[model samples]
Target: MAATALLLSLAGCQCSPSESDTASKGTNAFQRVTGDDVESDRSQWDQVYAQDAYVYGKEPAEVLVENIDILPVGRALDIAMGEGRNAVFLAKKGFVVDGVDLSEVAIRKAKRLAKEAKVEIATINADLNTYQIKPETYEVILNIQYLQRSLIPQIKRGLKRGGVVVFENQTVDQLKLPNSQGIRRDYLLNVGELKELFKDFKILHYSEKNDGKQAVARLVAMKP
Candidate 1:
């Protein structure tokens, strides 16, 4: 039964911290995060937020803003939410948003910023590898500037019918650029890889763009 399957998926979700989950700012303060390990990544991101009121700035990503009209304005999830810029933006647009990240410190900052924005959003501090995404529960899911290939299936299952997913992250081509420092090879998507992953879905838009020093892939797809 579909209900049974959904229940099983939810049961498989993980939320505990791993042994590598210790707190320390990484050697390179500006080092890139590849979703390699939750603890070290969390520590680095926490430090980033502690120093900047909004590390990526207060605006929603351009991809999200440009495609905002097509997104269903209901339950939404923001993966690896960082300082909650996108999550807060969605909340303001009347979406009930839930944000998840490995950094408790980042979540704290997100909650504070949400309050400042006069919008409410639920937040969870959990490692992405262990975090269980509730199945078919959200009308929209936003994954920006983070990539975890293993999470693709979960992302598909986490969306409600007619729901959309907006994802953007660096591509393997980024490795060729000198400015693309600290980005791990495995974290970058190969050309056509992002679209191929969601082949069965209705892809509204997809592209690979050279943004300064990094080559990035962006996609907007909907569940059938």
Candidate 2:
């Protein structure tokens, strides 16, 4: 949920690798920011999640629900899993789920939501900028509405061979929307940038579209 101020309610279209080939490439190089930056980010999210209700609601992201059939049922890691919507959904679907977020409040709420949903999930409160993702650890990784360019490589390495990664986040075009104010530009993806970031993986589904409320980029890819 990095810099995602608005709720996610977008749909994406399917695209091929050739469709994304012309897009500018993205880097996986580590770009560490100041400690203050990390602290500030966590504080803001903590405030948002401290509310009594879920900021993004309890249902799983539509992208994950739509593509569940293609994902393998096994250990799954939900990155920036804020409030455990997707993580809980995965657990209920028979996956052993682990959710990680920067805010302790979010983690607490996630655990609560998991209990309410009658599913078990592990929660870790950590800053992704510095947290280590164990290599080849998960059968599936879910990244929804969060972007940390530097974490891309770690995500790739964290997946077991043949494992899948489901990712969805705001695109630059989201800025054009009236409710897009306050969303950080750096957290937004370029039209084909999401696909470019995971170019090495077998692209299963990729899309960039404006679903009226927000423009988003969604991808489902499998490690070879």
Candidate 3:
């Protein structure tokens, strides 16, 4: 199989069936936005992360696990870092890590997990849609599962020269799966779209594949 067609298991794709139901029911509130419109999204995620168990499990994404050695260790940022599995992993590997998430509950859980692992990671609770990443700041950045096209420029600007970005998210083919309901098409990457997004960067790894459960796009690229 070609590199982009290889099937590989990745973590943090979605919550379990029970967990999904819980998030829809809105069982918890974390950061309360005063406006009725602003709080819905955050509240839903807060509910998901509020559970006793981690919604996406504690293991870091398989892509990060496989490609860590090639990435330069320095200031690392995890975007939309729900519960901080990746952040903690990078910290253990000796990176100064910062994790940002909209859910305060998730941030709290991430801190707790870091404490349990005897590592320290700075956690920021902010909406990625409005969050501003400092220009040319991070040596490594991880954008796993979460997709925000509007944030792409910020991601590019946030990296210093030669900085690498590791990203993985569901592809449009994911709708072919049996359990793909409620997953919005707008959120899915189109075929070859992932590569096209980082066309200017030097791509180290790129793949689009179906692994029985879901179809996903994975990419590792370095700034010029």
User: Whose lDDT is greatest here?
Assistant: 3
Whole-model Cα lDDT of every candidate shown, in order: 0.75, 0.77, 0.78
lDDT of 3 by residue, 26-131 (tens): 3221111222333666676676567776766677888999999999989999998888889999999999999998779989999999999999999898767677
Candidate 1 least-lDDT 10 residues: 1-10
Candidate 2 is scored at a TM of: 0.84
Error of 1 at 56 (Å): 0.5
Tens digit of per-residue lDDT, candidate 1, span 130-153: 788999999999988777777899
**Model 2: per-residue Cα lDDT at residue 117:** 91
Of candidate 3, the 10-residue stretch with the lowest lDDT total is: 1-10
Assess the local accuracy of residue 13 in candidate 2 as a C-alpha lDDT between 0 and 100: 18
Instruction: State the lDDT at 169 in candidate 2.
Output: 83
**RMSD of every prediction:** 9.5, 9.8, 7.2
TM-score, structure 3 vs. true:
0.85
List residue ranges in candidate 3 displaced over 4 A.
1-36
- What is the lDDT for 61 in model 2? 82
TM-score head-to-head 1 vs 3, winner: 3
Task: Show where candidate 1 strays beyond 4 Å.
Answer: 1-30, 34-37
